[model samples]
Target: MHHEAVGRDLSRKVHAAEAAVDHALIEIAALTAALPEARMRAGVSGVTGQSAFDDLAASLSDMTRARARLGGAHRTLAALARRMGLGAVAAGPMDKPDDQPPLDGSGGVTANMVNEM
Candidate 1:
């Protein structure tokens, strides 16, 4: 009975985490669509190039990195929750991802960024 309860608990956690990630992905997608890919790739040339666009680029870069970190952390948590009990999750081919961020970060252009991430 105890083991069964543990399995149930782990299952709940895993399910919740999955839902949270799904929601996060939607938000990330919106942020990605707003970014100007051309400008981001072009970047700014010259030392001390202190322009409004430069600052925006810096902010976006940071945001991308943060998103990557957040995905990693969530995966770690999900792994822990899944491991709590034998057969907590399913025993099958490891087809799921490690929750890696699809985008890379520059620094952190704004609170909303996903493309560079």
Candidate 2:
């Protein structure tokens, strides 16, 4: 394949990866916000769906870790692209600047963090 073709393929893959990460993080956030509302809807009667809540929390934590790892992989891929002379390829939209601290190692951006920005 031509160099331009290879670069285009890499850029397309990067965009897809960014979208995946963004969607996963959004889902995680939604779940996080929903848990409390769900518990309230259940009405605290001693049984507060504690077990389910605990499980969800664990799942969210795992997802956060996974997001971090995926972010690292994204960064590595960006580095590889740079080495290949692709230059600075923008993966996706970022509301915050690069200098801002990431919510986690994931480096994943979301509108939820806009207040922090």
TM-score top scorer: 2
Clashes of each: 12, 0
Give the per-residue lDDT of model 2 (tens digit) for 79-107.
56545645434435564356333232355
RMSD vs true structure, all candidates: 15.2, 9.4
Candidate 1 residue lDDT tens string, 34-85: 4455445667343333454465565566666655675576456444533442
In model 1, what is the error at residue 110, expressed in angstroms? 40
TM-score, each model?
0.35, 0.62
Name the lDDT value of residue 5 in candidate 1. Answer: 65
* CA lDDT of each prediction against the hidden true structure: 0.47, 0.62
**Which regions of candidate 2 fall more than 4 Å away from where they truly are?**
44-46, 88-91, 94-96, 99-117
lDDT of 2 at 32: 67
